[model samples]
Target: MNVILPTVITAGLFDSLNPCAISVALLFIALLFTLKKDRPFILKIGFFYIISVYLIYYLIGLGLLKAFSLFGATHFITKIAAIVTIIFGLLNIKEYYFPHAPIKLRMTHDARFKISEWAYKASIPATVVMGILVGIFEFPCSGSVYFAIVSLLASKVTYLTGALYLLLYNIMFVLPLVLIFVFATNRVVTEKMINWQERQGRKMHLILAGLMISLGTIMLLLYF
Candidate 1:
């Protein structure tokens, strides 16, 4: 699998540390605590939450890759997509290096909706609904990152390959978040998360953004 999805997964986890993600995580933690929801329950909700968000995002990426193939993008268009990915990737790099660049992600730990009272099957629908909602809800902010992957997948030889590219992309993208959810659920390790984000998060983000841009640039050059 192309590393792009994994790269995105890393980005998402690291992003959790940024002003946005940390804030969301903290607020989420607080929110969970407020509801008297135990760590175990919170963890389960978050697990489904991540799955919901990722599945929708991954499907969108896959669909877009296939959709664009039918367009048979003109050389100009393909190059343009490559260029956009490069630029958005740079935005990530900029945020990494100079975090004060007014980058803010207004994420909520609010679960998009809470379903603790519902049965497992009812909650299953919540994932589908939440996935679709988050996909549409966060599109504007996440469009560039999503586009970066789409552009890369579009470079593949076949639509199925492109679909697989996105599938892996989502997996990679979720890596950090899963680990985080694990730690966040652990009473022992949770304290470290918020403070770490405050001090060292930007550099982590820099590394992530830089890598994506670099890969995007290389691909752009090769396929431009």
Candidate 2:
């Protein structure tokens, strides 16, 4: 309980710092500002978008947990997840150093373009779709932490308990977005946030690299 709880919380927080999701969220806010939407409307759109991301991510976790349990491959999955997490960490480091790396963990160009189109729509349904798209597309960049956590849950807890932990983890996961939406309601703050994200993006990858490498190494040492 002690170790697992901390792991879930830390992993969720780390994953929330991912560039993919944050970038899209900031873009959505900027778009809303350009549309001259009222504060209430903007808040409504943001709420639905965040909720969509939360639900989609939660469902994805449930699916992975069920698959691991059904296959009786918790051990195998954990080993693979650890290895993949380390590889992703190294990739993040590579991204930090060589920003033009041929292989990168990020949303595809097409996904970004599609998301932008939806963001421009500035409608509730469009924002919901954009959020779902972000939740799915951002997985490539941010999923290593989630995979590791899910693998741990499958190995250490029953289905119901794992579901509960997943719920908690996902709440933490979308927390940053929630905070950003709450605070960055104005154009000035939103623009500053976008600039900050662009400036600190590489550093975020570096931080993620360190955390992922450390977590993966620990998992390997303890389980493998």
Candidate 3:
């Protein structure tokens, strides 16, 4: 079977742009600076957080793919997923226009509060726990894209291939965080990074919407 690396890469890129994760990471970076100018501590906190998020996503993807493949191929369900994806895309696009729209892809207030509390502690274990919790919190917002990717994987490849794709997807998902942390700690474009996010946050939503719409349309066409 042909490996759908492109799909995995694109999905990972889109999923990684989720505001919840990025916002929290940015806050953590800021907290790190406020707490101390300890570069090593910053690196350790960021590393653990990123790795924990990747591991949680990998486990979820692996288990879900295995469970999904057990049912064998389900073209009908895939078609439904495509439709749902398109709806999610539209909702995302709507959010660009109505930023306060009832439909938003974001973490719950409780989750946000918990993360903030954990981030302030600036401990490796706490950061790791925060990462795991954040991953779970953000899943509802970003899971559709991952689900779509996994559905495609289950339909087109074997379980092992699906697992490999999940691994690749998660690595790419955390790449931006890794880069952002490195830059912030090095004092390279730290302020610029935050500013850019402020300016491009809405635009990111549009881009994700377009990506989902395109991917869903193609899936619909392919499956039908």
Candidate 4:
């Protein structure tokens, strides 16, 4: 139990640092800014959005854990998961060289458009919906860490414990969004934040790739 909590927290921290997630939050903040520059409106919408993302991601984790649990803690499943993680890791690494590659995990144009459309509604409920959609769209980019942690939970932890860990993980995952909203409201998040992210994008990819590869390799080594 102790081990599982720490592992899940670590994975959550890495997943939270994911550039893909950060980019989406930045876009949402930009959208909110366009709609209303006031701190209250932005804070309200952003808070709801983060809540929606957190709740949906937690449910998804539960679902994945339940599904993976059905596989009966098989070594084969771990091996397969490890292999998939490595493939994703390698693909992320490749993004460093071919940054424009269409293969890098990202939201489809359609998905982004839909989220934007939701924002246009200018309602609290709409923001929640947009958050749900964003979470779905971000699955590809964030799935590796989620899957690895859930797989481990399925094999080694109880459902309740897994759920608790998931709660912690998701809270960590959305911390950046909260911070972005707070900073943006305070006039701290400027063009510089965006520019910095752009400049560091490649490096973030490399870090994610290394983390994923290391995770995969660790999973693989379990069999040895």
Best by lDDT: 2
lDDT of 3 by residue, 12-50 (tens): 998899777787788789778888758888888889999
Better of 1 and 2 by TM-score: 2
Over 133-223, each residue of candidate 4 has an lDDT whose tens digit, in order, gives 9888888885887888788777777788778888999998898888887886754564557777888867777787888898889888976
Model 3, residue pairs in steric clash: none
Candidates' C-alpha lDDT: 0.58, 0.91, 0.83, 0.80
Write the residue-wise lDDT of candidate 1 on 1-224 in tens digits. 55555654554443233344333444455446555668777678777867876787777777677777777763444567657756765676776666566764333335334322222333445545644565555554335556655655565557886677666666665565577777787554666676777677566556545655765576567664
Q: Model 3: residues >4 Å from true position, as ranges?
A: 1-3, 186-188
Q: Where does candidate 4 clash, by residue pair?
A: none
Taking the tens digit of each residue's C-alpha lDDT, what string does model 2 give over 87-143? 999999999999897998899999999899988988889988988998999999979
Clashing residue pairs found in predicted model 2: none
RMSD of each: 5.2, 0.9, 1.6, 1.7
Two-way lDDT contest, 1 vs 3, winner:
3
TM-score per prediction, in order, is 0.71, 0.98, 0.94, 0.93
lDDT: worst 10-residue window of model 2:
31-40
- State which candidate has the highest TM-score: 2
Rank the models by lDDT, top first: 2, 3, 4, 1
